[model samples]
Target: MSAPTTHRSAEEIGRTLAGPRPLPPLGATREVPLPEVVTETLPSGLRVLAVHRPGVPMVEMRLRVPFAAPGSVADPAFTARAELLSSAMLTGTATHDRVGIDDELAGVGAELGVAVDPERLLVHGSGLAEGLPTVLDVLADVLTGATYPEPELLRERERLVERISVARAQPRTVAREALQRKRFGDHPIALEMPSGEAVAAVDPGEVRALHAEGVMPRGSTLVLVGELDPAEAIAAVGKVLGGWTGAAQARELGPPPVTAAGPLELVHRPGSVQSQLRLTAPALRRDEEGYAAYQLANLVFGGYFSSRWMENVREDKGYTYGAHSGTEFVPGGAVLGVETDVASDVTAAALLETRYELGRMVAVPPTADEIEAARRYAVGSLLISLDSQGGLASTLAALDAAGLSIDWLRERPVRLEAVTPEQVAEAALEYFAPERFTGVVVGDAEVIGPRLRALGGVE
Candidate 1:
């Protein structure tokens, strides 16, 4: 074979680099307008917000309850109570048994789902616009008249207990859960996984009590109805939920206390083939002034697949299959995390590289190319999030629950586009501190324990 022809001319290389490149702007200059929505309050103190869209034949309903699992109440009993009450709400009501509820829902072709977050329980459902009244009736019945049958409650409790037991067996789950518990330790937020014993210990009476106390329709509740006439939707909701009365005491579990700076902690699991590394620290809340800047900085670092973390850790070094970082913005300060699983042999190297990348973020501004790509991806992903009825409803409902105004939603694109590279760098410096992070690694203790102790000075 002929030697591969090497056109080793510096002039050719320089010409290639000097070629014209039409680059887009670094940040978005224009704002996308948000939909106009109406808001009102019901006699029962339920806050209702609605957005009217003519073409869709369906309405999305979401009920936001303020009773999120508190960080201070880490006992497995409370954790199990929160989850079981949310699930059992739909299993049966005073008038409709489980079978009846299922048949009625099938008849209307409606779907109901529940989600429990760090700070709230969201009961949401969707149905045809004309069938909203039926759906609402069912929702009201479930919320107001749910009777936690002993047999059904026992079944769900046992099922959840089994699920928790299975989750404990996975290394990734173990590392994440252990890190959360250590970070928040004894706080409600740290109770990410309920113990099987705790799940099994919950009785029907406790489920009913938690439900009655937590799911009150006072200032603590938000009703978001989408793709319907605002007046009509509000009227329907008020009529159905008006009679729902409860003097439930709202639990005043405040936000998680700021974590004290401490040396990294490692959870050693022997016989593990891969090392699961989790590096975490405190970060900005969703509504913080620096949120926009921090978001851009995270994108440049590891929020996206094409981010710096992935490029350096996976593409360049091949130390691990993948690595990424993100921040969860709850009622309290956000939790920032960078996580990955690497072969046991390269666990230490992976940790060093991750720390290097995190430190580099604060030391230097991202290149214009990197900044533009990150902004584009962030804005483009947001636009995609608005493409469906459910997506639109979800976005609106979440924003409403978080107390974000429509104007803020409308201006999100502009804010994202206007973020400068220097702003991202500053955000990184302000929010991320390598020494303050808690590093939890699950692997063979013999292999990683000594290395971690040497690096982190942990005895």
Candidate 2:
């Protein structure tokens, strides 16, 4: 050894002759430009939107038919019937049996399916670009002439009942049902999952009747995006789906009752080890001017993993594994919801800290670092969500349902970039105030009930 090695202090190693090196400035963000789109309404009253996104030789398709049930839809069997109809619709059509239908789609590397909610029934599919005609023809066959055969219906009905039973026993599902009731009272939106008994009672006649009544063309939308010519695509859709005719405009669910501020309701779940905490308040819709700022404020609150709520409740205190807050767009408005799950032993402690974080959102608001991070996330997420052809197709269908066009989506990046810290602070105070939130807590009554009652503002 030449000499004994001596360790240098970190400060000595860090200081350079030219002084501390400053961090390199951040690079400018690259923005992806949107492609041109062709939009038109066919003679059958179905709106068609097509875009030429020439990347992969594949195409994505989305069809949205307004299936909002009228007041008369409260018929005891209506919800059950609607659920079964969505599952049974693709089992067979007049032109082809179930196997034959699948074979046609398989030959073209295509898959199609339907799902329903309180608002609409969405038919989604994808296929090779050259097989557009085959896909459209299959869709048309189902749309106008699906026959809910008894054998298929019987099998699907049993599956539905089993799924419903398993889902209801879940903690998250229990919380969702309780939250829906608290927020909407007796509104149809609160009736998300039909009882197992109701589903078991549905027969083929009810499903066919529901399809004829709800699956109309006038207010429906179809979107196709991939390697194709937009103009040709629109013409093809019109020619293929020309026979899908309906006279009346599809009904839409009216705006839900405004969420009111009140005390928390304790929905009892017996002998639970974990408690689900959910909270909700009013928020601005996407079309509203203040929505951008509100969106940023929401992120700083609990919308992301690094958010203040997460930092306090998870990193700092170790009370829960994860927490979240998000905006849900309803018919005419939007709402903010915060959710988390914590062990029953710490249920009261978690609630106190949650309320404290909510109060701090209004009192202290977010710092410059928090605001900048949330704004950047908002911009980056919007761009990423619309980056692919399938993503773009789905976005178009959802926007069409809300009476918005793709232009609204293209401008979102700029809108998020322009939101100022002052605006976010104002929105935090206006909307995130603790008094404005009301929701349900799902946990064991014997374990958490007394602590929750002692906490007050909870019953």
Candidate 3:
């Protein structure tokens, strides 16, 4: 056998032939030009936004309809019907059976999906550029005339029931449910997922009725992005979907009761192997002034893997696999949520470190280095998010839902660059203080309860 080759150590390989290689300067960032968007509201009341993104020969579409239950407290019956409606929406229309619908979509190299949450119903689709008409036509056919056949309803109801049962048992799902209830007592937005019993009660007639009442044209938006002319795409969409008419406006979801900062709720999940540490507090909205500062402060704290909280809680202390914090927008305002999962044994220690980081964020505030790093990351990530037609389409749809236009996105980088260090510090103090948050600690109470109670912030 040949003698084993002498191996170079990683450090030796990394060395230049010199003592140490000098780091090259970063290339200057070039300003990216945004595509001009075409927008119009059809006579039938559907708002259409189209933009050209000729990077690839594909088209992406997104439709957002405010589909919340029209009340302060969510009606479980309506929530269940909405779930069943979304599942059955693409099953068939007046002229096509389920397979026929599939065959037609496949013929055009297109596919579509529908989903519902407490806030809105979304229909997202993608296809070859040449097949945009077929996609829109099929979408219109379903939106205007979905007949929830009994057979499909029976099967879908069973599947949904099974899915809900499985989801309710998942640790993440249980934590989220507990957190929602802890944050907003009985608000409709807290009902993120329907219960199994609620889903089982859905019937075809009720689903069809919800389709008639909730899936209207007004207060809804459709966004199209692809390798095509913007004006031509907008006109085509309006022409094709002109028949989807209704006088009733889709009900909009109002903002929930504000999250109050108080003691951390301890929810017992006996014999659990891991504990979930979830914390949340109110933050600024995207449209608000100094929002960019809030974004940078969030990044410096725990919005990215290289954040302070991640360094302290996971890297230094070995408390978790990962830790994350980010801003989540609601109907009107926004909130910052920080969360991590750790072994039950380390639950108390993790919570302690988490609170320490939060207190540091408030008292010491982010340094200039941290602010610059976060700003660079914020600008880079924003550009990356819009680099694809699908991403652009999705972003536009979400912005429209929030009553913001593409101009906000186009100016985002400049806004981020202009955020002052003082603003970031102010945001940190206002949003990331330990006392500003309330949340839940979910795990085996018997294993974690004593230590958490000793920690004092957690109840």
Candidate 4:
């Protein structure tokens, strides 16, 4: 083959490859049947949401308990105690020691994990459908009969402290911590994680007490999605968790207060080679009507790989390897956040470009093509995320907490499709405007700080 006398430049080749093809006529979305959801509140006040999803011979369980500490000023050690408790809860129970518990779970091809945030404690796991009873039994044993053995508590505490130390040294973590502090002020939630000293001070007695006080059934929700019948599952849950009762209701802290945005803070990380950027603002919850528009707007901006933010910052400017912005749902509300990491030399330029893109997205409404691509991605990803048994169960638990049901979830694609470019533009104007975001950049202050302040917005 003869070489071409003149080769097409990379830009020409790229444009040719990226040129849009005619979109086929959209087809009617195949409706996935909503699983039958049966909800039962036990006499002891434990709420159970059981969904019968056929096909898989596995059961996924998700439990959410309102585990926030009481008072505006949480005990300095509360987070530490809770972390230790979550780690040690399954180490040993009255009926089974740590080894025995693991062996029993292995026999059922199951595993369980406990996690805690400021607002809730989550217990999640999966097992064979035939092993549902065994899983529940083991879970109950851990919840009610956990011994909080001293040695296990100490081991977990040390491990967590080590992890926290490593995490605290990370640029992303430092950025997040600085942003939380600036946004929340002295609020207890601003603490994020406990100090290493606090973790070391936590003991078995404190963990046991935290479990006894916060792990009650009144405000906890158990969600099960599997091949089993919903009614049967609910009944089984009632039998096992019926006697686990408590009078104390889980405290519901209303939504966190929203701080006015646009104050950029700098977190000094000495000798850092790269800077972590995080821009965040208060956002709407999934249940809100405007949330659909907001979500589409986010996807079109930086929520996806092919978004405008990534196209500009990574593909065009080569300022960062990756960039993303998305909404994170917490107990009462949501926060929209954008994140990226860039070399120290380009930190200011990246921030400037980020702000420019944020402003431009609103100034220029998305094209029909952009809107449709984002819509398809949003709908397709939602379906894919719920394709598995575990994903379905976790999604159910979260939606239930938000007072939504499976039927609502099944209709998400339709809602996503209905989001218009006008709606996205409006959402961008309201939520994604650069002035509405306050954030932090963590880097070597000597390298990036003067330049950041010179760019305006940074204080």
Tell me, by TM-score, which candidate is best. 3
Q: Model 2: per-residue lDDT, tens digit, 419-456?
A: 78889889999999999999999999889989999999
Any runs in candidate 4 off by more than 4 Å, and if so which? 1-23, 28-32
Worst 10 residues of 4 by lDDT: 13-22
Please state the error at residue 100 of candidate 3 in Å. Answer: 1.0
lDDT of every model, 2 decimals: 0.76, 0.88, 0.89, 0.84
How much is the lDDT of residue 231 in candidate 3? 85
Instruction: Give me the overall lDDT of model 2.
Output: 0.88
Residue 337 of model 1: what lDDT? 84
Report the error of model 3 at residue 141, Å.
Answer: 0.7
Model 1 stretches astray by more than 4 angstroms:
1-29, 69-71, 223-225, 457-459
Q: Which stretches in model 2 have alpha-carbon errors above 4 Å?
A: 1-24, 27-32, 72-76
Among residues 3 or more apart in sequence or in different chains, the pairs in candidate 3 whose N, CA or C atoms overlap within 3 Å are none
Which has the greatest lDDT?
3
Q: On a 0 to 1 TM-score scale, where does candidate 4 land against the true structure?
A: 0.93
lDDT of 1 by residue, 48-130 (tens): 87777656687777777777653456666777788877667778888998888877877877878776645677888888877
TM-score to true structure, per model: 0.89, 0.94, 0.95, 0.93
In angstroms, give how far residue 148 of model 3 lies from its true place. 1.1
